[model samples]
Target: MRHLTLLGGLVLGLAVAGGAQPMTAAPATTPLSAIAALRDPAGQVIGTATFRQMGQGVQVSVEARGLPPGGHGMHVHEYGRCTPGVDPATNTVVPFGGAGGHFDPGMSRNHDDPQAPNKYGHGGDLPMLNVGADGVGRATFTSDKVSLTGMNGVLNRSLVIHANPDDYKSDPSGMSGARLRCGIISRNGLTTRDYPLPGAQDFPEGVAYDARKGVIYTGSAVNGTIYAVDAASGAVSKFQEGGALGRRAALGLKVDPQGRLWIAGGAQGTVSILSPDGVTLKVLQTPDSPNPYINDLTLAPDGNVYVTDSTRPVIFRVDPDLTLTRWLDLGDTPVKYGPGINLNGIAATPDGRYLLAIQLNTGELWRIDLRSKAVQRVMGGLERGDGLLLDGRTLYVSRNAMQVVSKVSLSADYGSGQVVAEEPLRGLRFPATLAAVGGDLVVTQSQLDKLQGGTPETPFRLTRFRKF
Candidate 1:
């Protein structure tokens, strides 16, 4: 009687300290959620877990089979790998050995009970998973110690299920046996054809992605903030806030060969050089004489940077030593929207001989000779060109106000081209810019037109356009 009473008291105290209250029915969660397949050592998926943002907390909906119709110790593990291996130190073969201990980013190592949300244990602890008679368990659990946003978030972490059930009070995994299931979390949004940028209300006009690092980056013009997404983990964090960028709007953004970010300073008469972590390195300022309204930028094969000016008639060039020079002068070229202002988008040839630029007034594609400064109209009637992306011989032109993207094929020389296809994006509010991230076309819905017209609602986003 005395032992049972003491045990009951200990459980109650632990539960109270950890704030272990009954979990309520899950309400609708924010769009910050990820799905991962629970797999065995044989690479066979046995279940799935979807982690979602629930208010200030997080909730994971788990569903699977192959259990023994009893309680199992299911937890978030430390490592993301799920392959079976031998622990090198001991050379002991284990099930899902690649998935290390419980996921405790801070290395708390205090494997406390998941129900008791106290500071006594590792944040990865979870409640005992109850499997039914049919060997399938379906349940939802919530936690306040971890979330899906900002640094050190739970994305990219692994979920693991033990062969035995948890004893609840034991430290360091509750004597749970070998890991039977393991899987790494992935953003539900990125796995689909269209990736959603939730809560982006500013004019999102720039996008940059590193396929190797699985990082997705975009910037907001109004707020002047840069946002980054860990494509592997679905964790979203602000890479840079606009205040550090002064009043200049981030328009066209591109990653250079040196892994630095070259940003177009719209109407700021400058180009900003940013570190890979979104820190401002230097500003390539223009001469105040012609009033450069630098809008978009691209790197040529010669390692020089070329930027188009929306107001001025010339394109600015940045040399290796940060020397700013006049690259090409369009001299009031007739364009689709009329003369005076032209050359909104620019791209350089891979061989470093010619440069392709679009005239905003005439919708004509012009190829400019790099050495002679000679310009010729290659293709005409490409209206409202705002942003241009070149893939092989293909050119993608973004018509900001029109919400349309035109894809065309250019000939070998700086001469002619044909329209391959067009994608309408105006339905996305007001898409203003684009970037190619891996196999998809990343489009930013700037909503600049609405802001210009005194629209009450302002919502911004980076919409992924996948090529079928």
Candidate 2:
């Protein structure tokens, strides 16, 4: 926050956080501090912010231009997403609305100074900025309310510059004016990545997240061993050995609403139904076939479990009681695979009327009518669509080979789709699957390309992106 005087002179300069003199130089071994670029809804990069560790606290330098001439409130927002200033229909000040409110870890929800370090103000609240007549401003200050490391760290959070000045005592953020720009903070220009199952030859082909349990589940595609990952800590532990887990490879996983862990046994031609405690209660084997590969499974609101068979041109169905049967042989589309793998990812519509499945080898998205058991190709050429997830009308397809997540919008008829956007996740080694926890999406970096060449010391990890 700026230290102001009666003369209206902007009085804040870059200083060491703990009141000590600013360091003349960063150590050779010490890496550079964090940085972020604030962009408005129109995708204009209007401001830049940096975080540097100083004597007592983290020092933050903020520089922006083209802002209102005078004081404007600045703070970190809760969400990383930066949305437009107005709802097209409402025409209200929704600027950076997707970034949510101030970063209030606690529900205090008040707007106060970060220097106070009290429960009264939000931790995100910072000093107001004073733009000159030129509409440009640069100020640096330290905050005791934030840290460069630890759980309360600012990484991945959104930095926002507001339109109006902060009164310093308003109930919520000094009733700060609409957000003008926002940028997600990060270190070394890196994305939010967790792990690649982190070990030599560890390929996590599938990931299943249980929001209720606060746990994520995945397994080794090579040995069919199941492991549990701590969502908060990134800790990995062996949950179930391969002895009881059916099949040669554990490919896909889903945590059903009933708390059961449904696993697909790739190449084993079966699905394993396990208790929440990791006990294999039953194994539902697909009908006898030359080569049956149950690749993935998703639970439908209609109380049925749907499985995708990559080798067979069929969608397998498993009842709540563990009874397995051929729900539909989607013979409408021929099998287009290289190594006996085709249909890989499956998702059920919220209305429970249609099933959307994507073929791995061909990148074809097919919509299957649940009632008639008929299949229709909605679109094709997704380029290695491995995991398919539906949230409302948006379908997120993870193209493993292309190393990108394509977000498609489904038409009202559910028979067609258009690529709305693509999240180019270049950091992903081999993202095989995706799961949504809350509004955030987590991707499993199976690193199959590395693992395929045989065991190496590099471990695989998960990459996460927050939407809200």
Candidate 3:
């Protein structure tokens, strides 16, 4: 079995042009500090705002980029939530409108100046953020209206950036045209929430989510035990027993458009497609190989599922009709399958024209034309890329060993891309693969290294990064 204990150093390319990389997370020892990662409606994190305790008030510092050049209103909202919802006032959908209104717990009811007395203005009101032509903005000031631990504290609330400038005297949000970006305030600064699994021997790898049922599914690497978790309630239950239906190891998983679960059997050279109720619909196998390691799988627009085999340098395609075939043999191409995990995560373009895959051993990204079976190296420097999720033109790669997720913005033609951001999955043991749910990213803490070095952590878990 190819144990996922491979830890290779990463070499990332320069960041995307004109984009502001997210700030490094603050030290956990920092006292009374909170951070909010402001993200746009597209769910891309554009900037961050940090708050620190200073005497009786809170010192606020905000930095953001990739925004329009103008004066934009910034403020703290009543709720910590940032999901889109219909505004009660307009009865129309608005981005970050779920955050409710300004932080006026004192019932000030007036949207006065930031310099105004606390009793005369909303506590959430902040000075207008002036963005430069380069699409960057920075502001720092102290606010006496909000504390970190007192009755008026804004912990777990939300910080929002508005589309237009604030007039400083208008009532109810100062005519801030629209909520462009918003982030939840948290003491540890990170928005990842942990969901505990059943036992310690799991060493889970692949992760998938059923949006219709709000349930998350992960498979055990130790013995192929499939576990299902309720996304809303964080409840854990067994979806499938280990070694069921001859599945020895579950490496990668995906919920197809039909809600069926497609699982990759590591070292077994098998792929299992199970119905929503855990019944085995079909089990497909690849050709006999000496060292076949079925690593990951992805669904395409054309109703076909493409999978990767890390050892044999080949890809497998499972057609919608349940037929399985060796789709593309990389041994015939320039992508030499050498030692280590060769191909790990796989993603396909929405148009189903190309398939993007990563080389774990060499840190190279390749694009394969579906029609011609031609392969081209699109980008490199993703050595430990484990799981991939493509949203629009953005490709997110989970660097398991690095404990970070690299955000890559692809070119219009999927021929080129650049790493725009790398966010650390704080407190995660070893993030393997990831799945997107709404605006959040649900990741598997594989902890494979621990399985190799020592005892795995008790009660394995999954992590959810809010609006990642």
Candidate closest to the true structure, highest lDDT: 3
TM-score of each: 0.55, 0.59, 0.62
Instruction: Please provide the root mean square deviation of candidate 3 (C-alpha atoms, Å).
Output: 17.9
Error of 1 at 382 (Å): 1.5
Taking the tens digit of each residue's C-alpha lDDT, what string does model 3 give over 119-216?
67888888889999999999999877775543356766789999899999887888888899899887653345678887768988999999998989
lDDT of 3: 0.80
- Select the stronger candidate by lDDT from 1 and 2: 2
Q: What's the C-alpha lDDT at position 165 in model 2? A: 83
Q: Where is the poorest 10-residue window by lDDT in model 3? A: 1-10
Question: For residue 78, what is the lDDT in candidate 3?
Answer: 72
Residue 440 displacement in candidate 2 (angstroms): 0.9
lDDT of 1 at 70: 82
Whole-model Cα lDDT of every candidate shown, in order: 0.67, 0.72, 0.80
lDDT of 2 by residue, 256-342 (tens): 887888888988888988889888888888888888777899999989999998888788888867789887756644444466468
Deviation of model 2 at 30, angstroms: 30
Error at 267, model 3, angstroms: 0.3
